[model samples]
Target: MKKNPQQTIPFNWPHMTGKELFYIAEAHFNGRLAGDGPFTKRCHAWLEERTGCSKALLTHSCTAALEMAALLLDIQPGDEVIMPSYTFVSTANAFVLRGGVPVFVDIREDTLNLDERLIEAAITPRTRAIAPVHYAGVACEMDAIMAIAHRHELKVVEDAAQGVMSTYKGRALGSIGHFGAYSFHETKNVISGEGGALLVNDPASAARAEVIREKGTDRSRFFRGEVDKYTWQEVGSSFLPGELIAAFLWAQFEEADRVTRQRLVSWERYHALLEPFERNGVLRRPIVPEGCVHNGHMYYILLSKDFDRQHLLDEFKRNDISSVFHYVPLHSSPAGLRYGRTHGGALDVTDTQSAALVRLPLWVGLTHAQQDRVVEVVGSLTR
Candidate 1:
């Protein structure tokens, strides 16, 4: 079969385990489509077993999971949560919604993750927590971050939305923090259309985490026969996803290892292909520091200072190759201006990196030939 000359490669293609529809049908046959049903239990168990967190609860999205973290922390108006400016809006928005002030921190140059060294300086008397985002699946320096949090008696929420299956040292990215959140969104390596899970690492907070996920009720305990009746226990919202979403996510969890391996293969190929560009000072490839194992969640290139990122992206469009830029630093956004404050006076690294980075087409079934074409376009346009 001849391919269409104008066919465009998408920036992301959701992976399917072939059992998604089957499981969805099974959920229907079981006649339980509510939240925390059998499939939800299965997914929760799988996450707890794999990540070794004290508890796991599936949420509708990573944003929802983060919101649950905020509620669990009991964030009040005027309370501050420190985080990186170079991250998705949800990382800050979740806390901001709880009447909390998001204190924007700078990210490390190499990993583009929240710089642990600067976290201490951002803390104040009203500081409630530190939210570290694992950028592009590469982990933040959790050991240092945790030590600082411990010293300050503050909470740590790991935004591992892109860090699922990735690890820091020997520990899973999300498992190391007090609360870790995962995303199974269609854009993520593992897909359930739109899904996420919160990993509760602290035993003390597990029960409350469940209650918060269940709209501030003890409904989970009631169903588990732990309570005579479930009632509103605290301030919370409906964060849990329905049974059908869990059923779909269960299939992804079953094949999570395989999907991660395939994505790593693609990610490595991009690394090798982009090496020459990096060496020639045309572009820079991602840097994964030692002890950090990434899940190949994304492959993004940073154009050298002299090169125009938009120009190269336009070239990709002309060649029918889909390429895009990532987040605009949250500190610069309108909401951030209104609801947050920047720490350290200047976020030089975040501003520079966020501007130069561009993500290329990457997915489970992307071909070597297609990758070659991507590199070719990159080289032609940049050189």
Candidate 2:
């Protein structure tokens, strides 16, 4: 089979560590294909140790982890959770499912992250938590957000779905909040096909997080031989991934550092390649603030307002490139209008930044030649 030079470069390609199948076979040999098996425990230990969280629990998806966080927060009807509008719906849906309202805040212009400055303004008597999503694996202003949370007696759920292997001021991005949710979706820097984890930073909520993940039971205690039998105790659902998934993830965990390093190399290359276009005002490259270490999970360019973004996208398509836009501001979406409200009257930054943003093809194994072609297409089309 000959390679096609004209074939489109994909936006993402899941990386493998060459040990996935071997681990899966080992799991089968161990006779524990169920959740919380040996492989799952190993993954748990890795997450807890790497992130320095009190407890780490694997879940079927980041959405599940967030739902677990929502449950742990004990969000009641009419309660409010403040977060940015320029994020995945899961950031809001997780709370909406618990009958809580999502108060949408605008994003920061530079980092495209939740505006920690605006969070305090959105706080009200009904505010239960502040969910700051770490966009593009770049950390939000956790110190300020945490201080606000403390002042208002609010919880912080760091939506660090893209923050694995990334840090803020030397601390892991997800570890700074009261709770953190990470995604291991196929498109993420790390993959388990479709998986995630919950980081319980507060010890008081650690035990209940386990219960909520296990369908609201002290079944975790039972498994530890602390109880003779497991039984329903509170509000929870099945959030665990099977041993097969854990086995696959363990292979990725083994190579996590390598994966991050490779991705960073490619990210830096893109940064260098796009410098001229940025100077010419063709587009704005991503901004990584000082003290915030990112995992190179993404590389995006924000086009100027006058430029025709869709025209450039069509050109990329014709040129066999796979550049694409990011999220549509959730505050204006159908579900958002129905289940949430925009704070301070408008999400000006969120709407503008999301519309202009175009994510390039970034993945673990993206070649220099492929990246050149991708950028070449951008320059040809935009210039």
| Runs off by more than 4 Å, candidate 1 | 1-6
Best by lDDT: 2
Positional deviation of residue 92's Cα in model 2 after best superposition, in angstroms? 0.4
Pairs of residues at least 3 apart in sequence or in different chains that clash in candidate 2:
none
Error of 2 at 375 (Å): 0.8
The C-alpha stretches of model 2 lying farther than 4 A from their native spots are 1-6
lDDT of 2 by residue, 1-383 (tens): 74443366888878899999999999999898989999999999999999999999999999999999999999999999999999999999999998999999999999999998999989999999999999999999999999999999999999999999999999998899999999999999989999999999999999999899998999999989999999999989999999999999999999999999999999999999999999988999999999999999999999998788998899888977877998888999999999999999978998889889999999887888999998888887555
Model 2 is weakest, by summed lDDT over 10 consecutive residues, at 1-10
Q: Tens-digit lDDT track for model 1 on 275-371?
A: 9899999988999999999999999998999998888999899888889999999999999999999998889999999999999999998999889
| lDDT of candidates 1 onward, in order | 0.91, 0.93
Model 2 score (lDDT): 0.93
How many clashes (backbone N, Cα, C below 3 Å) per candidate?
Answer: 0, 0
Worst 10 residues of 1 by lDDT: 1-10
